[model samples]
Target: MASGKWKKRIRRAKGGHELEQAAALPYRFENGHLKIMLVTSRSTHRFTLPKGWPMKKRSLADAARIEALEEAGIEGKVSRSTIGHYLYWKRLKRVFIPVKVRVYPLHVQCENARWPEQKQRQRKWLSPDEAGLLVDEPQLMSFIASLDTDHRA
Candidate 1:
């Protein structure tokens, strides 16, 4: 998707709004129905996709795949192209920072019985609509809703 479509007002301090770099919308086929994985955030316990900052020496898609392994404990073929982008507020020590995340779709091939952050977060598999309802951000929810028919991934 075009980045212009997601452009929004970004509040900044001395530096600027932070970019999360990459995020993975992990999905799998369960009995012919598509289900997405949503993980609880470490601090707030709110539902969110597996995401993190960019890693050194890795492409955004690779970093997104790594985040899925670390945050959600699942890995598979990550789409080479981004599906969409969204803006969210990340709570900091005294303020909320705007974060722009480029999203990629992961066609989940397997889920590990044990992986990093296995105990820190609870993962749930739900239909796209159900997952959208659980997520807090309107843009993120819209992205999830778009996935139902989006074929780029």
Candidate 2:
């Protein structure tokens, strides 16, 4: 439903510029140790953080929170200020989408929630260094590094 609406919106945009989006990486501290959740694509099975384009009529922060729940299947408090953004090309139509992702550092308080879409996907809990290496983008790696530092402090 939302994806269909998003496709329609994309069609209506001038010059076919993709809409801005936001995402979140949920992390938590248990016993004074920081841990983060990473998901592997069911298709490619590449480990990465949860992310998606924001739906129409939704705030960036709200969208990020939704993505965290839908993609990562975890609910937590999301930060107001964005950590950073990154850009990449979507191979579906060879369109270069500039995604202004807002990194919400979530403090997860629970787990074992329902995530139907991500059930086939592999999930793992790893340290920040491991997460940084899992991400392909340099900027994203840097962002994860900063998050690691923040988690430590």
Candidate 3:
């Protein structure tokens, strides 16, 4: 599967590193213009993509799709190939763990009114530039900027 290739592409640390996560960049077309979806983080409430720890039994892409379903209440075709990767610090108890996130693009085909995190987080559909401004992570912002061209291609 492409998972092996994805693993090979990751730059490993010489000694050790923080855990990795999977995320989905959900997008859809609105009046021929591409719009991307961003969801608020549960605690920090920052605008972010749907992401979570990797699921042991599912491929990374599948895990990404699951995250989107749970966090954004959306489902769609997820690309097995990763669009890109990013690093972010996740707060845990007393420490901030650096997390490497593998991102997959999901062409959202459905949005459920009620889903697992519907009450916990807010979801919004914004233009690529608008979405970029909403996100805090620099890597994520670049990814958002690239979404318009990537989605078309």
Candidate with top TM-score is 3
TM-score of each: 0.86, 0.81, 0.88
TM-score of 1: 0.86
Sort by lDDT, top down from the best: 3, 1, 2
Model 1 stretches with alpha carbons more than 4 Å out: 1-13, 151-153
Q: Quantify all predictions' global Cα lDDT against the true fold.
A: 0.84, 0.71, 0.87
Question: How far does residue 150 in candidate 2 sit from its true spot (Å)?
Answer: 1.5
> What order do you get sorting by TM-score, best first?
3, 1, 2
Number of backbone collisions per candidate = 0, 0, 0
Mind giving the per-residue lDDT tens digits that candidate 3 earns over 1-153? 265533532333322655788999999998889999999999899999999877888999999999999999999999999989999877654445578999999999999989998999999999999999998889999888888886663
In the order shown, what is each candidate's alpha-carbon RMSD?
Answer: 6.8, 2.7, 6.4
Write the residue-wise lDDT of candidate 2 on 1-153 in tens digits. Answer: 466764664564445655566767778876787788887755467887677767779777778878777777788888877888866543223333445455766777666556856667767788888888887778778877787788783
Give the winner by TM-score: 2 or 3: 3
Q: Best by lDDT, which number? A: 3
Local lDDT at 105 for model 2: 69
List candidate 2 stretches off by more than 4 Å. Answer: 1-18, 93-98
